[model samples]
Target chain A: MIKPTLHSGEFTYPEGTYFQAGYLTQKNAGWRTARPVLDTNACVGCLQCYLHCPDGTILETDDKKVTFDLDFCKGCGICAKVCPKNAIAMTPERGLSQ
Target chain B: MNTRELSKNEYFFGHKACAGCGGSLAVRIALKVLGDRAVAVLPAGCMSAVGFNFPQLAFANNAIISTFAGTASMMTGILAGLNARGEKDFTVVSFAGDGGTADIGIQALSGAIDRNDDILYICYDNEAYMNTGIQKSSLTPYGARTTTTPPGTVSRGNEFRKKDMLEIVRAQGIPYAATASIGYLQDYMNKVEKASKIHGTKYIHVLAPCPTGWGYATDDTVDIAKAAVDCGVWPLREFENGVYSETPARGGDKAEYLRRQTRFSHLTDEEVGAITGGSL
Candidate 1:
């Protein structure tokens, strides 16, 4: 589904004719059979997992701890693969909860 | 600078690319470099299939889906409009696959590069049209088997040599042109940062290995990508202002790179040797 028309012509440019640049189609799930779980205790704040995550679902805390936003995490295991400390682990995606 | 120490804002997530997808990884890394100031112009390709799946956008930045051949054209128009609006703070990036870059969109790409448009064009070469199944693209190597170029008694995978896209982009005398691989993260990130900052048509051709298309183990994508570069099968090099600087080579065998992927499973020992010997 695309918002083809910009409903209101409030912008400098014409409303409906513009390309629908940012639209979220559907919440895609059922793709990842496994999901990544991060062990914050062992995490050295190296950020390899955060840097290597294909999906930007990993968020850095103010204290430098990282957490996964499972709403969008596709369970790519890239975080686990790139973690030099093996602080991240991939388990079956039964649910977001470990 | 410690490449890993750089903090980045992630722009792509909640997408549908396969596990260990090098293309998606490349986009992630590129977006990290481009940050919030860039708009990505993508055409019909794998990135489109996964990232721009209609309503659910994975990009934190503005991403426009253009026609298969209109990637560069769209970026050009956007940049021009922004320029007219005195928007000098933003960067326009055209991201397309090997099929979109080397085949369908090459004409527009060439024109944009020739004009030296102030945009970055990233060709994430997965070596085939992976979005439409493993069909061979112009950038597919000579001996790899794609769906269209299946090996049999009469044929041995794709027969044509891969297009030298770095040369093609460089031939336009652009400000910067280079080839990077997803396997080497630090190097890839460094190059992406360099390209994003450079003005006037910088082209980065990235070898994004496809597990589905290349018939490789999903976990081995990065390793295989690294092997390709280290083995000199795909040399990591950069062209800046018409000057070429090759990255120092790493020790690895082309045969090892080929042997890991099932796409090259049909090759005999002699065929692999021929490929390594540059005769195939």
Candidate 2:
């Protein structure tokens, strides 16, 4: 049997939120900017980088190539950090603030 | 989040933390990355007691205080219990100190990873037991000054080299692992964001320098921390799932990184070479 649980707050997050489990998010947890730009020509679809992105920013499209969610990318550079192909890079967005 | 935006984080203002307390700064950004949907499982350490008296919490959400040695396992159980209740969406975070993480808590931390419980296990590594007093921890580097590893008695502060936690966690074959610092705000924020979305155990070994413990100008926290990276004493690298990748070199003057702090006051050319030899 399960007891009735009394949760104090809602577990909802707004769009464009990034780094859901970091010190910056302890309060709002909703900071993001500069989404990952995946070059299909450069991406071989190995998915190694996809498996390790902490933000869930990267996604495998129906076509099987990888993509990313810009609204939630804090631009922490993890994708670029792990991409074996050196296919990923950080693009400084114009006034793209997180 | 960028430093400009980090200033506006919900937990950024009005709380009291010691001057240049890297752990507190780390916790600030760390908890920010964790968002309000998570529960902070803190052990008996600086991270737990930094103004966390009853009714007065720095965190706005659920935070639990557990034993020093079992924070990881306790968080593992917490995550499991939450998952069973359809509460899997909430993040369970274990913020352990270096003393708790690298030494006493390593066993339980390793076990939790082996179990692959979906949790973000973080070590706000200050290199020593700064809370109980500036004693030595396994994460404490060689030739660093601490009360236990006195320069007078031992010549070099910690006789032994700092244990390699990133490699040790990588050995578990868990989903994600990385080394982050308050110095590199964007990188730190991004890594935590990535860890939260991962499916299994993820570990972040953060290098947080304590001003009080490290004996430096309280305001020099960021400058000193940047030194740890620029000097190559602490490489800002990431290990994802099982793949290892070096972070883009922040390449700066090592002297600036060193001269900013007193803990490294004794770090001469020979000592710097030794530390660099191991990390660079």
Judged by whole-model lDDT over C-alpha atoms, candidate 2 comes out at 0.69
In candidate 2, stretches whose alpha carbon ends up further than 4 angstroms from where it belongs are: A1-98, B1-15, B253-256, B266-280
TM-score (chain A) of candidate 2? Answer: 0.58
- For candidate 1, the per-residue lDDT at B201 reads 93
| lDDT, each prediction | 0.81, 0.69
Q: Is the docking of candidate 2 incorrect, acceptable, medium or high quality?
A: incorrect
TM-score of chain A of each: 0.69, 0.58
DockQ of 2: 0.02
lDDT of 1 by residue, B144-262 (tens): 99889999999999999999999888877889999999888788878878887888998999999988888876666777788889999889989998899998778888888888888
Candidate 2 local lDDT, B1-280, one digit each (tens) = 5433432233322223453467766766766667667788889888777635423345555677788899998998888788778875788987899999989988999899899988899899888998888899998877778888887634766788889998898887978999987666578888988899998999998888777787775445555666678767678878876788986656776555655657667777777765655652
Least well predicted 10-residue stretch by lDDT in candidate 1 chain B: B1-10
CAPRI tier of model 1: acceptable
Top DockQ hit: 1
Number of the top candidate by lDDT?
1
